[model samples]
Target chain A: MKKRATAQEVAQLAGVSKWTVIRAFTPGASITEVSRAKVMAAAEQMNYRPNLLARSLATRSTRQVAVFVDDFANPYKLQLIEATTAALQAEGLVALLVNINEHLDHVHAILNADQRQVDAVVLLGTSFREETLADSRLRDGGPPLFVLARDSQLAGIPAVSCDSAVAMEDICRHLAARGFGRPGFMSGPRTLSTALGRHRHFRDHWASRGIEVAELQASPYSHAAGAAAMRAYLAANPPGARIDVLVCENDILAHGALDVLRHEAGLSVPSDMAVVGFDDAAPSALPGYDLTTYRQPVGRMVETLVDMLSGRRPHDTIVLRGELVLRSSA
Target chain B: MKKRATAQEVAQLAGVSKWTVIRAFTPGASITEVSRAKVMAAAEQMNYRPNLLARSLATRSTRQVAVFVDDFANPYKLQLIEATTAALQAEGLVALLVNINEHLDHVHAILNADQRQVDAVVLLGTSFREETLADSRLRDGGPPLFVLARDSQLAGIPAVSCDSAVAMEDICRHLAARGFGRPGFMSGPRTLSTALGRHRHFRDHWASRGIEVAELQASPYSHAAGAAAMRAYLAANPPGARIDVLVCENDILAHGALDVLRHEAGLSVPSDMAVVGFDDAAPSALPGYDLTTYRQPVGRMVETLVDMLSGRRPHDTIVLRGELVLRSSA
Candidate 1:
């Protein structure tokens, strides 16, 4: 009980060879019922579980999962990893964390390669291009691969994502409720699939709702862009240049808008100009910002991501609802 | 040519089964030279690398490393993971991420049993308690276990840690260079052996340099504690209450001081109050607070942590020298 009760000790008590003790835990592993019962009884007395390294010779799955994330330093990614790791641990699956840069080549390598010790791969979706999924390894035959918040045409590779379509609807409806008719959208780069999907879905939802979008398209997703976009929009439509509500693709952009509203544009959040953002990140909670945001449900999303691989969850596209946290910024 | 080719395809092309292809990659594994050359030639043709799942079968070492973190959402832990994961991946090892919340008993059980298929464990320095290490799986001859900036007595567990002794010296020397006398420390809980070690080392080093610490340990390291300590100290000792320099444990705590300084105490960072923080986090780089701080070499530490695990590194304390990043805060 110092750590592991030796197989020799189990053998000594059960009156059998160490090999017999090893065979008891090996699944689909053949051993006579009498010997198996004796070994199992002895193991139970000692409260022993066989070493996976030795018993894996007789097992099907290794109970290990690989988690891939694009920038570890990004607070948002960190939150995802936090919940995902916890979820994996609860099911007793080892979460193999892989740090990948913004490179599709590495992702393709993961998909095509079956030589890595991981039982499966969990892609923490962030700015993935469609071509990245085109890597042949992801096409059905590869070890069960799951993408977080991304959808792919390939079969069998399941995905767990937030309902971006519903998220957009919530944002638009919130804007209208705030007594703002013309709400502007400042988004991220057009290349990244998340940004693109959000943009298209937001537009389609708004169009169906009968609200004509005033200003749309990509912003740099940085503070400078938020300021520049706000200034440019006002400059062009100076006469009726009044967009009382603004929707940002993410929290950072919304932060920039808040600053621009007070410092540059001489406006305030929830007063002269109402704003909304996605990803209820930590910054939104700070005393200075307190932004009204669509909470990503990071806990549920990451836990569900882990649940999918362990067969505790069905291999399916899961979309969770996001709650809008009404804070001072809105 | 695009990525990795699977062993199954290589075996088919080589006119052999998958087991024969696996034996070719297994070190000192039994296989004929003629068959070996034939398999290698076929693998070369297919551009194949044996995946970790297949490789783990032959070798108990899964090329999977487990990093047990205290909290995932902490930006500091995120930085450590980024560096650690990237470093492990560079050596072709997949990092298994685990969060040990309350159930240390079960967590250790999982690690000892190899439930997640990890080959090694790296405890996050700040989060891991000493008691946790004393009862680790490494003691049971399971797998290589390492800790970051951990205490002594974990014999043979390779550690890559920040030289907090050197960090304190650098912070003290830098503050002295800025013409500040009687610098005070606002550090957190020493529950972590590293945090306690830093506090002890800092006090001794500063005293040796003829600089008496103006402030003793305030409750613990936190935003609330930092602000509370400052307020209490000012109330008690009004004349000598405001020290010219304040060296905080981290950026978060330093931010707490900023709030106290501007709003509560009526002082500015560098002008009226000189503050320095360890861990030059992103907020330190922002416009509102350009904090002069120590940039923990998380990347270097992570690489060393992983390398030590595979016996590619020496079993000794590798101290990383944190740089003093001077900004407007100091």
Candidate 2:
């Protein structure tokens, strides 16, 4: 590797003291234009650039944020990460991503981030355990913690997510207004408060309308899991079941259920079995699926997150509303 | 926010100087057992954690790596990022991600990362422009740059990726063995050497075997782009064309082609129009697609990358082979 040009070398080349070289590079620092010009010429000739790390030590602000995510396989999580990074960069912040696939790894990453002294920490799609939250090591007030998508209900923790309960209520009413009678819901693991909240709201709303509701649960929120769950449900209930409309917790699960309904159950979507999904994911908009879904306003959510971090808005539980998109599937 | 405990507070409570407090917190620092015990007790009582940023200035090593990615929407890239971050954390390093969506934003992010004095920089799926690579600002020897999944032929820049030429050869042989005659290729933008390499190899190998080759190009590497490209190709060539098999650049494009064949062309996959994809992405394994694809050895690639960054291996271009997964799509 080539040796980096230092301020001392540039200072010697410019025939000035090292302090003058530093002042020339320092933003808003008072330096004579003659010295600054000489330093700039020397630095440009020698390929010398100001060292940010040393400047950060003097300035006490790195403008870097640590971002944590539980799953990278899920497209929805990927979208969230992408939007978050773009939003952070727009405000002159860099995103330090930590993939918390394992609990121990998450804790270790958090410790490392604290040691690095990032400006803030953003947690995405994470359902952190209460023990982890209560650990005094994590509560050292090192960097401000903000959880996105998944709820972290611990005291003093800020959370931002789509209003799943309200979205589910809207979906249920949409189905009812479309003259759908029996409804079936497909979901991910019950441990996720996001999915559970939607499940409860859908069940309660359907029960209030005196309509029977059938439910299926899967884990890990993948296409295969959704298909397996649907197949298992069909085998137990047999074909020609009365469930006219199927509602899924997310687009991935819905995509799998759509496959099963057509190929396995020999049912035509919307005509025989209408399907609804959340997240209005990119794949769901394809011609094959074209699923009816709740579209989370990710842009607005990201903007709000930036606002919270910049002190333009208060750090608290903020629930954003999503749009119900009607497509061919429903 | 809660105020954090300072070393001065711990030192006052422990009846020792602030230097003793720093010694107690620093690893491998020489200090008396009596002073250490007192410092530890006071620190625990006062909830004091050593500030890492201040220590980094004294030590001059942050143990952080900056990761650059071009497309966040691509699941393939996300998978690579996830694996890379996990591998980095395993070796006591943190990943700072810079999303290069726009040229100016990318340059700004790069400059920031350079200033932060990260240990290294890993660029993922980036086909860097000649001007960007040749610019003295980027070449000022800030950090060791390693490009992943892109062929960067620039001198002093190391690259690692799947052996696209050999992988394409294997795919051609496999297709020939399956008696596929006319073949069609779908790809991302030609600017990407990864896609262009695959395209050239496929076209060359097919031509050598006296087979007709059809090609379609799409920018942005998205499902909608793939679908639009397929629709355009079909409209120009009409249905029932001689192209019996379609080989896509990635699983996403293959997915869109599958939709087009069924919905637009009214042809069944494998039976009438066999479809193959690369990357073996999560969605390709769904029953709906069940796409045949080549699976890159991501685990080994990540391990090799970490090894290269740590100097366990020399910095140079290394190509790894992938496995051809036979599924129902082909």
Candidate 3:
């Protein structure tokens, strides 16, 4: 194996000092451009590297933000984490990611265990809520926090999320406008407010429109669970007895349900069964699934969340719209 | 909105003191088992939390590891990050994620940046190899290095990787045995050692068996690049070139190329074309892709890497075997 390149080796080959190589990597450092080219040429020849750690350590205020997320498998949350991290990194901030799925106590333990290494926290798809108010870490002089989607009663905190109530009502209207006869809804676990809101809104809004909901209950937001739900429904009766359309809580669940229908149950999408999903995860949009679903304005959410963290949009709530991507599915 | 629960709230709810609730989150902190259960039960009811920062600062270990990856869009790397994070969290260590697409310098900046807090660094993919090695971050007392892949000659460093060259030979032999003719291969950039190794091994082994090799090169391990490379290959060939078999560098690239073949190029998998992927990312086994491929043991990689970090494993180099998964796409 070749020895990893070093700045000294390059310096020796080019007959230049090690500092010359440093200046080449350090953008706009005070040095002759010709010397920089020479350093690069030499470095290419021998692969010399100067220590970047001390330089990084010397530069105070590394703009790395500690981003806390739950369920890395969940595409919506993944997108949020990705969007926020990309946006922050573009602005020269590193993202420290923490998961909250272990347990609530452990989740907070992670926050404290991390020891405030992060400049601030971007809480994405977290279960953390008002109960943290009494914790000294959060209550006292802790790093400022920007929560996304988590509901809170207390004032003086900043948050950015799609207005859950409005987003849910719009989904219901879209389903109703499609002229669906009988609709069964497969929603996420009711524990999360976002899922609960969608379930409650779909039930309440559709009832007023004289559409009787057949099946309604909480299931984990996964393709497996969606497929299982579809399988169970199929076992209960023949295709004729099934509902005309099924509204899924999110894309993961929707894709799973569709998989069972198309692959296992041998049903065609939008033909034998029409389906609509939320969050519009990649798999759901694949040519195989061809899922027509709601898309949260993620780029906007990241923009507003960053602004909130920087104190640009404090004391205000953000409510964004969701678009329905029309496709081979519902 | 409900207030986020705290240890104090748990104390109030459980009829115990706040200190009791604090001790509950600690793994083995001394406290009455009954009281611990009460604190936990109360904490669960109210979603109680404690300050992990103040305590960790006192302990002087962040209990966090910063993970640097090229991009999360590559499903394979995303799966590795997910597994690695789960493993770290299982060991009471949290992962801080960094996406280097928009800014590669940010990753080094984080690792070398001393003021930034972290216990160690886990470089996730090939991106780490590209950074100038002479940089101090690669050497010196920068949190003990743990890289995954072929032996990188950074003295006293630890590495983890599946047997890529041997694994490619396994696939090539299987294709040859199946009477599949000279195949079309999609290789990652020549700059990447993993890509270079896999491509070279596949070519040599196929030539040994007197099978011709038609190959395409992608910029990086990604879906778009995979699609673009295939498009270039198809454009260069005659209408009936019959490039029936494809071996992709990884799962994400394979899926991307599959999408282009089905949607754009108008071909069927396994019938008109057989495709295989590496890294067995979870989605590859999902309903649509169900790719025929090699499964790199991520669980073992994380466990082995962490054991190396914790001194459980000897300083000798370790290479693992990849599991071959055959699905309909083959």
Candidate 4:
């Protein structure tokens, strides 16, 4: 391999001091345009690239942030990852992504993040429990921790999440206005605060109207679980017996419920069983499903997350609301 | 905020030297059990945590690898990201993820990766072209670059990619064995080598069998593009006119084509028009669409990529084949 040209070689070629060569490459450093042009021309000609590793020794700022996400298969998590990484880049911070599952391996992953000396760490998952937040190892040694899209309210730790309570109320009201009486919920796992809160709101809102609600919680936020739950519910209720609508906590669950309705039960959607879901994932908008759902403001939520990480905004539990999108499913 | 405790304070509390304190915390560093126990007790009592950034100045290895990926919405890309991150973590390296789109932003992202002084860079995308591979900026000053899942053959650069040509040949033979004739291809954009090679193989194999093929190229690797292409094809060919099966270049496109067939075209999947796809993403196994597709060996590919990055394997173009999975769709 050919040896890379050094700053000293560039300085000699440009007929300038080493200090001028360094200043030309440094952002916001004061240097004359004539000297900068000469240095750039010489560096370009000789393929001179500054060694950032050596420079970081003097600056002591790596400008890197670590982001932890648990569910890689979920489309919502994927979208959040995209937005978070882009926002980090906009702020000139590199995003070090860590795939932390609910298993014990996540503990090692978190410790690795601590060892990397990231500027901050963003916890972006729904499955992280209070114990994860309360881990002394994560709290003491790691960089400042912030939660996004999950309700993690540990001491001195802040979170940014979607306002699922208000959205659920809005959805319930919308369903009632459409003359839907019998309602059922295809719920996600109760371990997640977001799913638990949404389920509670759904039950309370419908109970006030004197309507009994039926619900089943999927083992995890997955399509197969949704289908299995729906199938089990149908086995008990029998076909042609009515549940006017099924409100799914996530789009993936709703897709599974729809699949069960069409294929297993031989029931037509909306005409026989209307369906609604949250988090307007890409597939829900397709012609086959056309699911009516709530669209989370991921772009705005990511901006707030970056601001909190950079200390530009206060560390508080900030919540954002999303509007309901009506499609053919309802 | 409380000021963090230092190694000097721990050493004083433990009645040991500063060097002993440092070695006790360092991974794999040799120190006596008694000294390590005393240092740990002191650190626990005082809430002391070593700063990695300060130590990196002496060690010179940040143990970070930057990964560049485009098209975040694609499920295949998400799967690749998950596998890549886990592999890097297994090797004691942090994955610095950069979400770059097909725009000028990727150029800046690459430069930032160079400036961060990561140990290496891994390009994990199918959309990257020769122009991106040949950019002098990436070649001159950056850490060693390795392309994964793309066909890059630049001088001094190595790539590990899926053998799409052989996989396509296997798929065609499988289809012919299943009594499928008059096959149509839902092609992706022609700029990508993976897509171009797959399309070329399909054409050659079908032409040798004396069968005519219909092809439509999508604007992007998305479900919407697949739906549009299928809609155009159906409009051109009347209902009940023979196009026996549709072979999609990817799962997202296949999902779109299935949507078009079931909803817009008012046709059943296999009985009316069979369909197959590449990249057996999570959604393909859903009950709604049991899509027959090829599953890429992501785990093996990621292992090879890490081996190449760490100089454990030769820097040559390595290709792996995917297996075809049969389901109800075909």
TM-score of chain A of each: 0.78, 0.90, 0.74, 0.90
Candidate 4: tens digits of C-alpha lDDT, residues A1-330 = 345577899999999988899999998999999999999999888877686656654664556788988887687678888889888888877788987855546656666666566778888865777676677776774678888876765777787877878888889889988999999987787778342367778888989888888887786888888889988988888655758899998888898888899888888889898999988988888776789998888898999989988889998888899889999888
DockQ values of all predictions: 0.39, 0.59, 0.19, 0.52
| Local accuracy of candidate 1 as per-residue lDDT tens digits, B1-330 | 243467788999999987899899878999999889999999877767765554565565677776777654345667777777777777877666777765555346435535444677677764555565566444554555677744444566556777788888887777777788767777666565344366667678778878777653444445556677777766766644567777776776776676577657776667777888778876566554568988888887777776677677776867888788989888
TM-score of each: 0.82, 0.92, 0.76, 0.92
Chain A TM-score of model 1 comes to 0.78
Per-residue lDDT of model 3, residues B272-311, tens digit only: 7889888887778887778999988888988888787667
Residue B274 miss distance in model 1 (angstroms): 3.2
Order of quality (DockQ): 2, 4, 1, 3
Residue lDDT tens for model 4, B1-330: 344577999999999998899999988999989999999999889877676656654575567888988787687788888899888877877788987866546656677676666778888865766676567777775678888876675777777877888888888988899899888987888776343367778878899989888887786889988889988888888876758998888899999899889877788989899999988988898767799998888898999999987789987878898799999999
Clashing pairs in 2: none
Which candidate gets the maximum DockQ versus the true structure? 2
Worst 10 residues of 1 chain A by lDDT: A109-118
lDDT values for all models? 0.68, 0.81, 0.70, 0.81
Over 4 Å off, model 4: A2-22, A32-60, A105-107, A194-196, A239-242, B3-17, B26-30, B46-50, B54-57, B193-196, B239-242
TM-score, B chain alone, candidates in order: 0.80, 0.90, 0.78, 0.91
C-alpha RMSD of candidate 2: 2.8
Ranking by TM-score: 4, 2, 1, 3
